[model samples]
Target: MTNSAANDDGELSLRWSGRVSLTPRILAVNIFALALLAGGFFYLDSYRSRIVDSRVAQASSEARLIAEALRSVEPDRRDALMLRLAGDTGARLRLYDETGKLLADTRALGLRNMVLRDPDKQGRGQAAARFLDAMIDTVVGAARPPLYRERADGFAWPDVRTARSGNLIAATVWRAPDRTPVITAAAAVAGQGVVMTTANATDITQTVRVERFRLSVVLLIVSLVSILLSLFLARTIVRPLRRLARAAVRVRLGRAREVVVPRLPSRRDEIGMLARALSDMSLGLRARIDATEAFAADVTHEMKNPLASLRSAVESLSMVKDPDLQTRLLGIVRDDVHRLDRLITDISEASRLDAQLSRAKFEPVDVGTMIAGLLAQREARGVERGIRLRYDHREGERMTVMAEGARLERVFENLVDNAVSFSPDGGVISISATREQEMLRIRVEDEGPGVPEEAREQVFSRFQSLRPEAEEFGKHSGLGLAIARTIVEGHQGDISVESREDRVRGARFVVRLPLADRQ
Candidate 1:
């Protein structure tokens, strides 16, 4: 018993072991898609970073400019300047005394809050003096001033502080009457306490938002276009491969005598190069097949004449020998003749099928009628062998298909003969026909010991057969199923075997052919 073929996993396993699968192509497409996605994300990230940096720089520079403007105001005009600056910029202004007490607040002064003063006078004075000395040293190549002073801290001081002669002075600055909050900028004044200005950050933030929105829209459009183009490219690359895959399958099934792939214009690119390579490979394969067929035909023709002469000589020897010896010699001759006949027949059929396939005529024939006729013919042969033949047409009458009638009939005869040969005496052989969508199916089943699970597939290969258990039951030529499969495929159909147990209990051979629409 041999193991039968099984595809219970719902995966398409390639039968031709030498060919590579398309998994790598699929992986490459996915990889390219991921690259596109990553590129889009990277572009957006870089754009957002630039927008953030620009916003931050603008904010910092605006703060510095406001602080500088406030520092140049005169002490007498400081109050007026603060009011004007606060009103113009929509910001708050505050002055503190050296003691960390609030000295003045633009908004609070209106509410009579004792002109806010600072309490940390000594700390502010020391910090101011140090900063001034650093600035002088940087500008003049020498420290030109030291300003620090600790005072009884009731005086109002500006929010900005500066150094003068080892003292940090404190002074009252103007206040503004405004309800809107603002971003404040401060600078230390040299002799005066501090100068501060305020400006609205709202406009800057709004501008940033507008710029971000515009950039986002542009980025989104570009990303979308990029994705679409990537999809187009993926499809472009995959389409030719898909066609090549189908052509490969046809070649594997022995359906195609020659494969002619269409030229690709896009072959100037990498995918185009791949397509050209595949086309070249297909042409080479066709040429090799042609050469092999010619070789087989020449060899078979050369051997046939010698084989015929050998058989004739053996027959002559049998006629001149003793009865018992003659019988033995005749048996040997018969075996040789049968062997030669089978060899020549298989080689001839293989070569002819290979040659005629490219030009075989195809037309519509009723599948149900064809099966009925085959069953009728088989029934006549079965009756002589004490076997009963049964047939069932499950599909309604006149299931039509587009195929060559003679080739299809040969396929049918081969399957029926295979079933009949395996069927036991008093056993039944059944024929069935059905249609499903675009295909017509025919099945022949024999009640015998079913083929083993493993042997079912090998049974369809040339010269492959089960080993004979009893010495008397000679092994079959084994090319019947292979030839039948070839014929069925030439008609654009498929043939496969189904069996249950390891023993030859029963075997069902199924044939599927494309249905043709009736006018």
Candidate 2:
């Protein structure tokens, strides 16, 4: 999946921007709707165009057929042919010569036995006499743009001249004066000149208006549905976000208050992950705040003990005059000073231990090799004390782990040094490491008094030292065990102590670290 600004790992400040939104107004104000509207208009116009074209084409074909029939008549009796043709066709028929001379006009009836033009349209459709004749003529000749001429009329339309040139021409005009569409078709005859016919179209404007209204209604309904769907989508997107936003606001305003973050665990989207992150951050911040406060209090309490001792030593020295007493009091002062120094040093290192571990890069290091090196250093000091630091493992064997080798060695040093202080003179400290299951367990066993069952865990606490009776006071900081525990836990390991299983009286400090798995 692609990462987004909305992802959980993104900064909370960016996620809380006022301008960011889950609104889907983009869909409601649609571009596709505009496209569909334009398409509908174009479709209607195209349909209108097709209707007009078909009417014109039909008119042209019928005109050509009439012209062919007219060619069967003699030129002088072409007037009779035109009249006969007019009786059969439902159109306004007219005949014109190549020179634009009117040959016959079917607008009126013939004279009493003489065939002629009738401008009054009184004798129309009179052949084979009946009451239906006048009705047929009136309906057929309803549109007469030619008869209502301005007398200076020019038939300059391309179809007229085109027909006169011996070719058939069909033309349609929309919205003629009589409120009807008109189609005109003209064709040239072989000997009887050109025949022209005109027809008023059946009412299609009303039909088109009805269809346009229905289409508009359909489009309106579709647009409304689209808007409602977009609204639902917007609600779906914004509901969870609204809850999260409210929780964040509460948490921000009331910094110390516990805010319950909205958790949508079913949703595997960015929003759900962000909710989880916020919850974790809240809990972590509270915990760190509490821990730092406790640490500070503990540090102050530890430092006060040495300061009180130093003050006592100085006061006692000023009151004493004997050299032996003076020297002893001075030693006390010196020891207290050294104790303060050790406390400060250990405290400084312990305080920064977390940050140091965070920043330090880990590399592959053999735990066995590290323990061997540490023992070698301690062995020299042990030799002077008539004690021995021995490795129980086989030579050259290794247990590898991913760690900052220096820090890991410091962990071993603390345990071994503690063992040294508590061991009797000439005591042997046995150190060995072995892989157990998926973990590496290292034990440092010393011939010293084993920790009591009651204080076993507390021995790892700050300033909880249980030193050997023979060791000099204030020579070592009590922070050693605490610091070692901190470092081991930072490496996701555990450190604990118990009586040595192989011996009845000795103490065994066991350090269990996770082993690095190889691919």
- Which candidate ranks first by TM-score, i.e. highest? 2
**Model 1 lDDT per residue over 1-519, tens place:** 223345433365556532643445445555566656444433433443465445444434543454455567665776666566556545555544334354455665452212222324436644553344344335544322122222333232222433122233222222212111123334444434443333433333244345545655766676677666666765777677788778778777775565566558656887677778777777878877786776565555655654775677686784675787777667766766766676677667865885587677778788678778877776665464687877887556788888778878888887777776777768788877877777888878888666777887888766566643432332355567877988888877888888734344788888888878733
Per-residue CA lDDT of model 2 for 22-45, tens digit only, reads: 464446356466556746744665
Cα misplacement distance, residue 280 of candidate 1 (Å): 7.5
By how many angstroms RMSD does model 2 differ from the true structure? Answer: 10.7
Clash count, one per candidate? 43, 1
TM-scores for the candidates: 0.42, 0.69
**Candidate 1: which stretches are off by over 4 Å?**
1-280, 283-321, 381-384, 394-396, 467-476, 500-504
lDDT (CA) per prediction: 0.59, 0.73
Sliding window of 10 residues with minimal summed lDDT for model 1: 172-181
